[model samples]
Target: MKYYIGLDIGGTTIKCGLVDETGKIIEKDSVKTSIKGEEILQNIETIVSQFKSEKPITAIGVSAPGIVQKDGFMTTGGAIKDFFGINLKEEIEKRTDIKTTVENDANAAAFAEQWKGNAIGFHNYYCMVVGTGIGGGLIINDQIYRGGHGMAGELGMMSVMNVDNDQHLELNSLSFTGATVFGLLNYYNHHSDKPEVTDARVIYELADKKDKLALESLDFFYTALAKGIINLMVALDPEIVLIGGGISANSQFMEGLQAKIADLKSRNSDVRDLTFAEVKPAKLRNDAGIIGAVYRAIQAN
Candidate 1:
């Protein structure tokens, strides 16, 4: 059986995994992300060497943050400032002498869903990863739609609020300062005089306990997110809208979001006319990037 190495590079950690052709993870590990570009590459090389000692790796796949071109060039590396303007595929191939493929993290997640996760058999769908901010991936006609310059699925940049002034419109974007976990915590902490909480889970628990401030903040979050999903539904009309991220694992959050969407649809006649896409939690979760990257590698080879 041919084996592959998948690496998911994030701001905090670089998650690595070994897998065969069938999408099953054989082993997985992670290393703390480094600020320096060379250090990150070295870490990747070390991981590849360790994995290679155990099995002959056929290729390497990478799932990375920021705007990645089809040729594996990172136009903007998100939190990884050092990755900007670099060709990661060539770099990895040079270091490890293995064929390598690179993909955007959110798009990789969508690929994971298409391959073996919640989006299987769906010809068209959207995947949104809601965390500190939001990231999106679009699958059209069973293919990842990387638009001109590879900036197709940037859903977080969509403005949900109107501003009198043009400047700082990104601040009013759906996910930037509104419909995310960070936004929820920010809203709660700013409004509540009670000792500030950092975690979104804590706020959720407070809401469960009927804390007025927490409930209000969650209402804002749910409303903003519902509006964003509504916009996506009206525009793309996908078969399903899959949500991913740490918060998606919380059943309460998912149920609340679904309920909020339903409430909105019932209130709006225009939205009611549009076919509603089923909102579901992504099945792959943490392993999505790794599995999707490997899937891309498999396709490349």
Candidate 2:
């Protein structure tokens, strides 16, 4: 039985796990992602050793937040500045003397969904995660399709506005967390004259309680999110568009979103088969990235 390691290197923590070809996380572990590459590499090496103590590992796979190149290099992203221009593949190999591969966390999550999660057997689809930030993955013909420069799935930053538009609104302004924060703080500023309320959790808690301002915040989030999904669908025309993230866990939001999408589609009957991307919760949730990372490693070999 060939064993593999999946490493999810997020901005805050590194989730490492051992798995077989079946995608079950056998032995899981994690560590902090340090600023120094040497220190981070050492942590990865230790995890590999720990996993290897019981299982005979054949390869390693890594999932990080960036555009992963085919040349075993991950591009630096907006959130994690420490990984910029770093040859993470080389560093891990140097530490463990084992070959490995890396991919974008979004892409990894999408792959896991397609391979073993909710979006399985779908020929063409996109996966979006509206968590701390907005991002997603693309799959075509049952495979992760990283277009042109392996950055095709960076949907959040792709044309939130039109050309020659002076007062264009970038989509991030309406991100899941951003919308909630804006509404809360905007309300507080106008009402109580406070500083800011940036946490989405507060928005969730308040909304659950049916707070007037928090309800408005939830509307802001769902509206933008529903609009984003509709726009993505018009472009990609995928059969299924899986939605994930912390906020996606809310059933109320999901049902409301489906209604919003249906209403939007009803307004445009002439446009193709009027269908919205089915919004479903992520199956593996947080573990999808690490499992997908392991899948990539074994496939690369």
Candidate 3:
């Protein structure tokens, strides 16, 4: 009946949860991530102190972005400039005197899917999270594959399109730029004079209504997403690619991505011959980072 404190650190928010060994969330809370390194540590200390005050905690696990080492050393913080070159494990352990483990956020999500959600009993798969930007986790042979420097699975930086135009194409140049929710909204607003679209659902709804701009924007998104999925499939040859994020809730997004893949297969005989990995939405949504972080802590302990 031991409990673990799990922290899911992101650019905007830090989600903290007290989770049991069985992957059940006993209690959860969150706080804004401060840009300053010390403030971020203070926020984590506050949350961990509150959780510890109420329950007996064995260890702490954290899911973070950028290059996170097995020893919890963050060499490069993707969005949080303050975390660069910090050993977060020692920082938390010194304050709380509890063993801690840290993992990359996307890798943690992939582990969550294998542990208690979709991709259960699967040996190999890739997990991709699409949001402001794309994040990916590669699981090969049932284990998270951190590259030589523990910086693997960065799918967003992959170059997908190089559309040549007289105007600057920097906005839609990369895979992440073309396939993300922010990209969709930006593209939509860039084209139309209407009030800027805030939510991805608005774009989806407009597409469903046969709005030409919406449809065109979504078409670009699906094409880029399909190419990214194919790139993973061809490179990793995983059994399936589990997609997770806010937009994964929408059924049409998956359908659209699949349609693009199908179209690719129809035209490219090699793609047809080499069976692409099946794409499925992640069963666990936001709680994935918590569960997976707890899982990593337990395993490390």
Candidate 4:
């Protein structure tokens, strides 16, 4: 059976897999991304060659943490400085000898979920990712809505305040995730005479203890997230918003987020009838990016 390959590149590592139409990972593996040279492309080639050994794949898909141009080259990836303006498609294909398609990682994940996962029935909604940063994707009538320059639904970059006469308000790209992670870790550090601690997961693990500081940390996260959602509701009016990423896996935060949204809606009449996106776990989980990448590559090819 013919299969497709998907590659998800991150700051420190790369995850790639072979996926069929059934959304199964026929083969999966990871490798360190040696960004110092052209070895990044070599790493991807290695993964592709291994997967192709047993199965005849038709095309390749790349879920990059950058803006994917229509031609499948990368325009910009905020966290990774080297990938900016790089033609990832050509570089990979030159080594692998296969046609490749590229897309923003968050966009690819959202696309995967929309087509095969939780939001299967929704045509108009938003996909919010809450891991390293809050990234967003908009789906309108079953299509990924990339504004003119393939730069739509970048909710993380949305503005939230004005610092000066010339400066308007803006939310930090990864502030929500960082704040949520640090707020809890900082509290735990004060309670214990231990070494430094950092990680969003650490925060969640400690939430059940109901530590005053941990609760407060959660409060801070939900407040900002609520405001962000409100801002989105006011502007996009999407029918539903699916939450993805590692952080969204926690039910405690999800419950708190719901309460905050309810409170915010009660205060505004125009938004009184509005509802938060039907928040739920991304069915594809880590596989969303790979599956979405495969979808993009297939369509492009």
Candidate 5:
């Protein structure tokens, strides 16, 4: 029964899981993410030690946020600024005296889907995780395609709008500012005269009740996200587009997003001839990174 330690490092927390070779998580836990790199490393060590004490771990796998190179180097660490230029795989190996493999968080999620989730039979697909911001992963021909320099599938960086206000050119990409939960809240609060709500779920609930402000904000969110998906559909023409994140659990959100995409495609003549990829919610959900990391570890062995 070979076991692996899976770590999902995010801006707010580090989710830890002990997974068997079969991809089932035997146990799971999490710890607060630290702004300091050293503290983060120590946290990983602690989690590894705890998990190793209970099982004979074969290797460690990490789902890390940011632009991760193939050899486990962090070119940019997203919210964890301290991780820039650090080789997390080497760091974990040094701390635990065990083999380690690291992958981009979004890519890990996509891998999870390909392994045992909604994308089991699909070889070509795209995955987008929409939350505080948008993260993307691409699977082409049954392999994760991490383009030259490992920056491929960075969907959030794709510019959706060109702002030319005040005689200055500005580009708005699909990110926290426009297409995610953060964007929805910001847009809603900015327009609503009542008290601002921080939770995106609240806005969804309001929209369910036919609240005007919430509906408007959600429309904006879906429109922005649909546009991004439309762009991907035309360019990649994947078999499917799997969306992952906490918000993806909401059936309404998924339906609304697909509806918006259909609306946009109906109005566009150029893309009408292209076959659109089916958009579906990811199955692994919160456990995606953990399961995906473990799957990567299994492959490494």
Candidate 6:
């Protein structure tokens, strides 16, 4: 019986797990992510060493927050400054003498869904993670598409709004600014005098209570997100768009987003393309990255 090490590296923590071939996590734990690259690598090595002491590990799979190439070369570290332009696969393999695989965090989540979660058996889909910003992954024809430079799934960078000549206009138009929790908070704090909501859930709660300001903020967010979804549908015509993130857990938000999309399509005949794509919440939740990393390692082996 062979086991693999799965690591999901985030800005705040590094989640490590020992996974079997069938995606079962035998043991899992996490450590704080080090600000320095070398210390982070050491932490991973410690975890791997501990896991190896108990089992016969065959390979490792890492999910990182950045522009990770198929070969595990990170072009830009999303939040970890020290990881920029580093070849994570080579580093880990050299240190552990085990086969290693790496993938972008969002791509890992998408792959996990296709392999064992919501999108199981689906051939074409897009996975969008709405965290502080938006991150996206494409699974087309049953394969992950990383684009030419392994940076294709940057859906957040897409511009959804057009405004007059103002420096703030460009930032406001970005999908990241329009659709994410951080964006919602920014909008709520800047536009309304309702004590400055901190969490996105607070806005949702207020909207549920029929607070006008909260309702308006959510309306703006849903509208922007609906526009982005329509644009994706028009471009790729994917079978489904899986929404991933903490906010996706909100049934009201998902329902509202779907309703808004329907409403937008009905109003604009040109966006008839939206009907071709379905929107649903992702199923894997927090474990998606770990499971997907194991799957990637399995494939590499």
**Which pairs in model 2 have colliding backbones?**
none
**Top-scoring candidate (TM-score):** 5
What does candidate 5 score on TM? 0.95
| TM-score computed on alpha carbons, candidate 2 | 0.85
lDDT of 1 by residue, 9-82 (tens): 98779999999999999999999999999999999999999999999999999999899998999998978899
Candidate closer to the true structure by TM-score (higher is better), 4 or 6: 6
> Of 2 and 3, which scores higher on lDDT?
3
lDDT of candidates 1 onward, in order: 0.89, 0.73, 0.84, 0.74, 0.89, 0.85
TM-score per candidate, chains pooled: 0.95, 0.85, 0.93, 0.87, 0.95, 0.92
In candidate 4, stretches whose alpha carbon ends up further than 4 angstroms from where it belongs are: 35-37, 161-194
Model 5 segments more than 4 A misplaced = 162-171
A best-first ranking of the candidates according to their lDDT comes to: 1, 5, 6, 3, 4, 2
In candidate 3, stretches whose alpha carbon ends up further than 4 angstroms from where it belongs are 163-175
lDDT string, candidate 6, 1-301, tens digits: 7799999997678888999998999999999988899999999889999999999999999999889998889898787888998999999989998899999988999999988888987899999887777788899999999899998877777777565566665465545456555567777787886686668888888888998888887887887788888888889999889998778998998999999989988888787543567799999877788888999999988
TM-score (C-alpha) between model 6 and the true structure: 0.92
TM accuracy, model 1: 0.95
State the local distance difference test value for candidate 6: 0.85
How do the residues 75-159 of candidate 5 rate in per-residue lDDT, one tens digit apiece?
9998889899999999989999999999999999999999889999999999898877789999999999999889899888877
RMSD of 4: 3.2
Residues 49-110, model 4: lDDT tens digits = 89889788889988888677768767886567677878888888888899888888888888
For candidate 4, the TM-score is 0.87
Where model 6 places Cα greater than 4 Å from the true spot, the runs are 168-170, 173-175, 192-197
